[model samples]
Target: MKSPGLTLVSYGGKRYRFDAGALCTELLTTGGPGEFARYESLHEPADLLRWVERSRLPSGLEMPVSEGELAETRALRNALFQVVADRAHGRPLAARELAAVNLAAAGAPLAARIEADGSRGWAPGATVARLLATVAREAVELLTGPYADRFRECGSGNCGLLFVDTSRPGRRRWCAMEHCGNVHKVRAHRARRAEGDD
Candidate 1:
């Protein structure tokens, strides 16, 4: 089950729990440009549906995804990924990437509703485009939001996972303390022991 600000991410056949701080950045886990292309999952309509299922959006969303919509969604995801990476690394954001994201945001976002049981729900007639619009719109908000400067990549040199550091101290350094952070700690301990043997 997807929780707000957290997602179960699968890459290279392993799953890691990630906190992306926003649904928009969570979309980046599906794929990206260059090395990220290897992890691409948005090949067809059903693929996008699965992603929606794992997303932070209130669940029970039944959306129709067209081939055209899938294509647009991938493009938006790649652009969003690049922009966030640039933002996290303190590089200048690219206009082309920003434009791609803005184009996707042109559609109306998914409407939310209250079910008979009082549970939050997505309105009927959901479209992939609309769902992605919600993502893009949030991307715009996050990029310009007060917490925008908190965007970051994992501190581990071998890991490229991205997230927003929402800690009270704003010093979050890895995807999760239980994941990459643990691995980094173990490696540093081994290196220290090796040095002591010299």
Candidate 2:
């Protein structure tokens, strides 16, 4: 029951596909330098609940989320983005950002459970804090884990999404080949044609 807006672009390997879930918090930030015109998907409490319901989380975690909880979730997302971005740039993660994620995760009632298909997944408590805490914990694990070294910002001029480069050679440059990769190829082809005409 994935959310309609939850677009999962495969970039990393199977174990790290959750990176796309983390980056889905923000959208369309590749317009310009420091462009903050990004479209936020979690605009309301209903949006948050929808995400929780549709996410690949354990069942029985759906609950009525409040506006205040939505605000807190946004804050958590920002902290995660900062940590991941810093790691991508080879900068040290700030202690305060890590603290913010840990504080939220401390209140989460998440547990590992086996799904009907025998796969393991996280099941959060029937509370807003727990749901958000699950996501925060994921960010913590990703930023601190060895895969963090594979972080790469998208090379598209208008797509600044982040992804883990799990390629064998570790040279992945776009968030998705069908999207940014094609864009780059087309642009380059056009430029070459223009040069030939000149």
TM-score of each: 0.92, 0.73
102-183: candidate 2 lDDT, tens digit per residue? 8976775556777898866656446777766666766667666766687778887665676566577878887767667876
Each prediction's RMSD over C-alphas, in Å, is 1.9, 6.1
TM-score of candidate 1 on Cα atoms, chains taken together:
0.92
Predicted candidate 1: what Cα RMSD to the true structure? Answer: 1.9
lDDT of 1 by residue, 1-198 (tens): 356654454345556678888888888878788999987889999998888877788789997788998988888888999999999999999999999889878889999998899989988888887888899999888889888899999998877878877789999999877778888899999999999999
Off by over 4 Å in 2: 1-5, 8-37, 58-60, 115-124
Question: How many clashing residue pairs are found in candidate 2?
Answer: 0
Clashing residue pairs in candidate 1 (N, C-alpha, C atoms within 3 angstroms): none
Using alpha carbons, what is the TM-score of model 2? 0.73
